[model samples]
Target: MDPGLLYDLSMNDYLNFLCVSGYNQTLLKAFSGAHYRCPDIINIMDFNYPTMTIPKLYGSVSLTRRVKNVGSPGTYRASLRVSAGLSISVKPNVLKFDKIGEEKSYKLTVEVTSPGDDEAFGGITWSDGKHYVRSPIVVGGVRGVFHVLDKTQFIDLGKLHQQLNLEVRRKRRSKALSQIAFVGVLCQGGTVDCMK
Candidate 1:
């Protein structure tokens, strides 16, 4: 039911509280830094004072906690010299999105191309040369062959419809005009024109 059990933290968890004195104190002085002063202790028997090693003691101590798994990725982080009598515990390190593959594959393909100069190759020190590079050496252009399909392969409705409609309209208009013209000529020529 405990969260620690779920993470298997209880299996290989290690807790160490280390106390050092004398030469070690010099090394730890920076770690204590402006914080916890060793506590003064009093004992009834001859007023025996608690040594710096005791719990209510002066000076500083370091506590280190390390947790790891052989099969899984473990977090290891440290922040030195936080507050006096206060030690930092860093757990569960985070991985950034950039570290993981979260972006779509299409997003990675876009980039810019910068121009470069040939003089730079001859040992010429160009200014702002850091941004310049041999302009990506574009080798070839996109080349492709196109083939046209035969006209007989398809009966194009658009062209066929236009041609048929044009012919029919022309024939109808010509027939109507010819009939009108013949009637006009016959009327002008009198009744005998009907025989022709």
Candidate 2:
């Protein structure tokens, strides 16, 4: 979706953005005095924009995503930023590749331990210092531990927060409709809302 979603364009069952940047820093380094021929491309795996719902808290919730490097092999760093009322983390904070097109799995876990009753928001940013790619995340306020059968659907993890209480309140269950998922600008720098 790097150049597809308009945030304005509606694709098949998914939102679109005019442009997106999963931090592919090729042009940004081209002007350097030294010869820069390597391409550092960081891609978010199976990322669905707008936002994703955990469905149920049940004490803890976890998700996995795959990120692959299609450019020159190098090391890319992964960082997480989340909201309150939950505890989120990712495995292997530092990613390295010996060859191109290599992929890695990121296991993100979330645990709700606060009684704040406020929604949680955050994301995981993969950066090579120049290009910063962030997948935004927002977790709605929950009320209690729940178990709903047959309501199965999930997406990738972005941001995170909190990690203390096991007595999490269940969130509201509404069947209105899923949110319109859309990607923002494929920015290739620091954390900020951007589109181009």
Best by lDDT: 2
lDDT of 2 by residue, 1-196 (tens): 2311111212311211111342123532333433333323322223433244653354665665656665566676878786767777878777776775566666677777673456777788876664455666666654445332221111111111111111122243342222322122113342233221
Q: On residues 1-196, what C-alpha lDDT tens digit does candidate 1 reach at each position?
A: 2111011122112110112133244444455442333323312111111111112211211222222222223222222222222222222222112222131110001111221211111111101212111111111111122122233322243345457667767777654433221111222223433333
Instruction: Please give the lDDT score at residue 184 for candidate 2.
Output: 24
CA-RMSD of model 1: 40.9
| Model 1 spans > 4 angstroms off | 1-54, 84-196
Clashing pairs in 1: 38-58, 39-57, 39-58
What C-alpha lDDT do the candidate models reach, one value each? 0.23, 0.48
For model 1, the local distance difference test gives 0.23
